[model samples]
Target: MASQNILDVVVVGYGPVGQTLSILLGQRGYQVAVYDRWPSLYPLPRAVFHDHEIRRVFHAMGIGQDVESISQPSATYQWFNADWKTLVEIDWSSESISDGPVGYLFNQPSLEALLDRKAKSLPCVAVHQGWEAIELHERADHCELKLERVTMQDGKVTRSGETQTVKAKYVIGADGANSFVRKSCGMAFEDLGFQEDWLVIDLKPHEGVKLDVPDIGQWCNPERPTTMVPGGPGYRRWEFMRLPHETREDMQRPEKVWELLSPWVDPEQATLVRYALYTFRSLIADNWRKGRVLIAGDAAHQMPPFMGQGMCSGLRDAWNLAWRFDLVLRDVAPPALLDGYTPERRPQVRAVIDASIAMGQVVCTSDPLKAAERDAAYLAGDVPPLPPFPGLTDGLIVRTQNSADGGIAGQLSVHGQVQNHGRTMRYDEAVPTGFQVIGLDVDPQACLSDAALAALDQLGAYTIGVTHDASKVVANRVLYDVSGKYQQFFAQHDAKIVIVRPDYYVFGAARSAAEANDLVGMLIAEIGLDQASAASKSHASAVA
Candidate 1:
């Protein structure tokens, strides 16, 4: 017999990604349970930096200010050479992010602790601590989760000796690299292990050694490109290239570690706080979704630490997937709608993987000549250290033009408007309910009796008539350049109404009143947000 209990989502693995997912889903009114095997978090410095996008999500969750207060902001990046020579130093503090929070650094544990608290504070969220998931049950309409609860001390053990089953509409796996869910789902992970081991050391450099690091540091040491990044005051991190056949067993001795650090350390004054061995693999699950069971974070993709994107990638996964479930829970969409996840996210994850591998090859090079070539590329602006993609770059949503380029009303299209100004631009209001259309050349009388116009206004779409000004003209969309205010900006775009989605994706150019009506219908169906519309209602019946 199936359990009659109800849950919107059961997030497997309550690490950073899972926890963040739970909070977002819970806030959206979904009954979410965040599961993890550990009773509490481990205190250690693992990953240390987060890009501006992470900070933005935290802020959206209402903890952005608190996270900023606790985090050490590093807006500067520096790369070095074999002789500890400086190559490129880019100040990140002044970066322009398209959306979400900017760059910040916190030790892994501290960040986890904060997320743990946030998860607990969520209204409809449950933190299933000490619960180990042993099996998954995905049915046509729901999923059943089987878990084991455990408790143990330094020398004793006490446990429930029982299994708990949770019935949820959907599930997500956020476990680490060796993810049980990924394996259980029968998903294939393309594991390409070129270099597998690392000798990592975590410590704080003395005053004379610490650079006013914006939060990250990359070393181009040819013999061993050892990267040293500050975690917090009196805390830093070092990742050394593992020498041939040098096992962790051989490096257990403090003296042996001292010898490793001697080249860069002043033999008389340096001390090692924590040192251990690590391994890395470039693995991406062939797919992120399988039935009702899904995976995110390291469970989804694993790459080298060259780009500091591992955790950030998983967090983005949680952000993207959680919202889909929210739509399902509200009964506005069918569960199968989640199928779109893999196509949208896999490409971005692969891009991150390729970028990580390419970056690792560049920074971890032992050849002095090749190292110089890499540095020259950076200096000459031949390449970005890490290429920007959708999730990491504020989840970009580019516009799509209709036939003849502009909206049905081809005369008012802003087709080629590109924002090149140094200003960080943003729409004054959040997404409206339905569709938004920006019309630079508008008939003020058009607002009356325009069903599309009324719907756009009700939904908070940006259906505005424009007469551009010389000020702030770059990023803002300009149409029907009557005043010649955005002369340069308009030079690229034609006159037409530009339609922006609630998700900030451009749905289409509103070519005509008739096209505008059809475009709104298209978005309503695309997002599965149409609750009472007859067209969407009829589509639902046809699918059924």
Candidate 2:
């Protein structure tokens, strides 16, 4: 019943997604209030893999090294038949645009602890534990949230009769699968109907002892499909599919777990960290935003763990929303810019969900005959390779009139090392993350008109010239492409100038300075900066 000060954002969960969103907003000096029902961090591991793109996000948050310290780079993910014959092998060790291995494995609990510490350390972020959001009301200009303090004892939660009211310009439900905020907002999940129950077991081998196991692999045995992968630096995880005759309760028993692990290791060699039954399902929210209240992470989408992308997708959502929130909160863009969120992210998430389901179908084939057919198809090269992950197709990205020739509008921008002032560092570390007008061999500032340049400055955009010619390198302006990635990227795209969004997605690219100026103009108009700037000046005059 007590009133509280209005904040910029009220995040209704303290999980990794919530923590990430809060930290991003707090770093930008926004007042963020984060609430969680639990009193402390979850002690068990859940998600164990993140891609290089998410690693770049960690770097943007200034924790790239800390995250790398707790993670192990995944080399390859293999699928094997019942006879241990390799059916497929995905090379996760390949370098990506983020300039690291394609994927990594980490302990979720450790990551949460790191992110929680970072979020709380920011003066702009207020973290409240043991507070459950009871109600959310979206007003014309803001939203009101009601919270109640609760205590957990013996695996039961009890309300303490303490209540508080807080207001925020926006309310984000980064809550988990059963999100109360999602339910309150009347959003429904469109289930893709792919579901399977599996027992997930985490094990920690005794120090100095080694267990014989594939680093990361899926055993598509008709009897029981199994997954063996690293849980982190010093942990291992095994997942066994539940057969038709098995019950969830039976699969979670410690003896049953050890029986399943008998092929790999025994109790004497390793300690069981935790075991639980998880029903992997593919689901996406019908809507991500309902007025001033929005949902993200597991609240917006869920997919089978076949691709190990469930957590990665959620983190991407946080990163995508954080930059948009910053622009909207600062009044640099109209509120309608928020409308681009669902359209841009939904299709990409759906693509991943579909891919994961397709993979699950291949791995979860329990019938011996079907499994044999699947293996034969894979061995015979009859199955097509999985398609590359999709990019934004329906959002704020600029598309050519002929949609097929959209260029690299939605593809990820490359990040490579560059030399500036006798120092070599990653491009992002040298240039802060934002809208970047990067010229491959020309100066972006020289390419744009006065009006366009001023607009870029107003939007806090960075203009940099990158060239392979070392003589062209200038302090804080022109950078030498030490790794040649910039040249290669531009050459591949046939672009001399690229306009990258704050989230590292290319807005558009051009082959000439004139085209580049037009591209910048398109960006300014698309984001409605001109309208926002005029409104701000009008308001200032009225106040005077």
Candidate 3:
């Protein structure tokens, strides 16, 4: 056992979510300590899908190039009936607000490995593998974690006979579904009444082997509900719903795997990388935060993999919480700001889970008559449209019900290419982090009153005026909208100015200059910017 100074955050579980949070914090120059049970990276592929939103997080993490290198864009995803008729289709390759494909297929192992390397590369991050959090104690201002090292022999766990204690200002549980921190915080899960066993198999084709497999489709056959999809480069995956009479052992047999995958490709032709039975269920934590402790990722929610949002949701949680932590840790905002995380994320996650469950119900039917009815309805264009990506509805977002009243609150802002001083880059790269007051060919600073301008400045918001004309990029603050997406976005909202939060969600918008000042005023009052500033000054004075 050894002693160390109190860190900014002690993250339990160095999975994707934990690693992401650690890297984000470390990048902000905060000290982070990560604990995980495994001695090294987990080589198996579990989640093989990521949406554009998660890709945005990768961009924030400075790993967009690595992600793009190892990921493949998904094409149309189709649902088929027992007879292989297309019941419904979703354009997975559709453009996202982040200016990329809506969905991507990737090997989870490679993604995690890249994240691990990135997190460890940061001087502020301490990645302690082979260490597990055994206990957690929550204090008024900090959290204490008891960690231990365990030795394994022949895949069996044994005590390494070593233990240590670490103290941090906050603790995050990204420790998968069976999160110790979630349990330690005494949170309960509300089951969403969806649970089923499915067998997942990952296959990698030998170099230069041309193996035939069905397009990414959900076979809604009552005989055996199954999913067939490409698993990024050099890989393929299939999921089979277990029948009533089948047991876990029965499904895990090599013969059963071959039997299930036989329809797509002969198992003998491709290499069997891994196969395992998983119980797909829908559950969300009753509470995501308690005292100084919080949970994210699989520890907070679990949804069926039909929508491929399981991992994406967790990553979103990490992204959302990381920004909030940055503000709170810097004393720019009160701890109450963290209160918005659950209210904002829970609804989004619930919507995703509900959609996944509904999709699973449509694809997991064991009745032929129902499947036929579904097929007929879809063919008749009577089926429900695929739900749009969920947005922040009630948390920290400003909104107005009246269409005549301007407000794009709670919605995510669009990212597009921008040219600043002859350098072309994404809007996110050009604009500084924190709050951003963006205008369409107009300077938002001209709209704010002196008090409002002071408030905005205190919140660390900067104004960026974007113009569609390339000649308008004469100043450092005025960017050229290279793709015209920003212009179109403002026109669609009928807004002259928009207030974007650091996490890229639209806080509010204004249709006029006066209204922009009013919006800034409202934000200052709503978020208690003045009070925070006063309190911060008082604290600094007291410390001096």
Candidate 4:
């Protein structure tokens, strides 16, 4: 039976992406229903890495500590040649703009379990694990999804002969590469033409047994390119690229598996957890939204695993959509606000896919001659460094005519510790999560007009003042910058005030308080809040 009331959102898929989106929406008090065909969480490893930005997302979900407990911070990701010469080293152990290690490695299933528990604990979230979304219909204001109950029998999904229909104001497809919602909306992928197969194996070391390996790195040996990295807290993972001469069946044989692990550990030293072949690809949906239906995660983009951003990108999608959907559902922003999703996310996703493909190209080379050329280039410093991870490049952000890179807008806002009300905590914890107007050594409230103040209030924005002076710390409006990160950021950008969006991206930075007010005005204009407010009043009058 279908619920008589419409849900605020219905998520199709129960993987980490869907779980993350549901948790974010549910945290904002939305009625969310999640459907997954699988009878239970897939009890194996898949994605094994997440970066600092994703750590912030986990923090927002109130599971930061739990996730940290199950993961290990990564070290430098060193790539080596066939002769064991260092080709390139990417530092992942250093502190990031998000104020933590640049990356962390974890078992995907364990992370999913944590997210699942957090999502289901929310009062407004209903998780239907054994139901599969078979059909979807998007209408003027809502979407209808038909779900069939299924069971896992003999490791396969089988129909259970029960079905139901549910309605929601919006639907999200966090389903993987073969996404039903994306296909239902008649969307297509813009393939980036990168694909390769590899055999991934996970092993749990026997108690008190130790094996020396790279903390996290890739062996770009032309004979058999390999990846060795941490698999959560106590396990380890290794992926070997399938060579042209090796058949998939031959590679999966027990003897072959043993031969591959012989270089690292023997069977007696470690227990094989799981092993499978994966065809990594690079793809991005041409269009991410249709009517009230949208796609995220693997449904929207997929990339090779060389950069370990496959799961991070999806969680980012969830974070981006959560705030936008919150505003639309609350009528704080016009429905057109949803249009910004694709423009803002797709470019960033494409950048990652491109970067991942570039890295994969370097690691997946199997030709000895080409590998030698690549080694020489790296050894001689001819290889170009991977481009820095991209930020939002379009949509709903303030852009100046003279600034080509949006003048610090669309970049991640800096996070640091602050002292508020005689207690110290991370800056995000000091202020409520929403649009933030943070003044460095200035008072944001003193610079805004009454209209601007009213607009910010309507949008639930947090206007805060941060300064090095301890005497200036006020209960809710001002905080003491204990870590000096805010001061350094302001000095670096030469800005006095920074306007951060709900998703933690800087909307814009301003040189003065008046300019900060203008940034707020720009945000209000971009969101079309005035028109939305007018429409609400008109509807109320008609009802009266």
Best by lDDT: 2
Model 3, 1-544: lDDT tens digits are: 6455788998998889999999999998998999998888888889989988788789888899899899999999998888888888889899888888889999999999899999989999999988878889987878889988976555566767689999999999999998999998899999999999999999987777776656588988899998988888889999999989889899999998998888767855789999999999999997798878989999999999999999999998998998788878888678887888898889889999999999999999988888778888988999779767778886666757222144467777889888876878877787766788888887777666666666666676787789997666646667898888888888888888888887888888888867887787777766656644443331110000
Query: What stretches of model 4 exceed 4 Å from their correct place?
Result: 401-406, 531-544
Model 4 pairs whose backbones collide: none
Candidate 3 achieves a global lDDT of: 0.84
Q: Give the TM-score of candidate 1.
A: 0.76
Two-way TM-score contest, 2 vs 4, winner:
2
**How well does candidate 4 match the true structure in TM-score terms?**
0.96
lDDT of 2 by residue, 1-544 (tens): 7666788999999999999999999999999999999998878899999998999999999999999999999979999999999999999999888787899999999999999999999999999999999988988888999999998776588999899999999999999999999999999899999989999999999999898889999999999999999999999999999999998889988889999999999998988999989999899998899999989999999999999999999999999999899889998888888899998889899999999999999999999999999999999999999988677787778777212255688888888998888889888888888888999877788777667777776676888889999878777778899989999998988888998888998888888877977888889898889833442331110000
TM-score winner, 1 or 2: 2
Candidate 2 or 3, higher TM-score?
A: 2
Superior candidate under lDDT, 2 versus 4: 2
Residue 345 of model 2, lDDT score: 89
Off by over 4 Å in 1: 1-4, 87-91, 99-102, 152-160, 204-215, 232-234, 262-273, 367-518, 528-544
Mark the regions of model 3 whose C-alpha exceeds 4 Å error after superposition: 2-4, 152-156, 401-407, 531-544
Number of clashes recorded per candidate: 29, 0, 0, 0
Per-candidate RMSD vs. true structure?
7.4, 3.5, 3.8, 3.8
Backbone clash total, candidate 3: 0
Q: Rank the candidates by lDDT, best first.
A: 2, 4, 3, 1
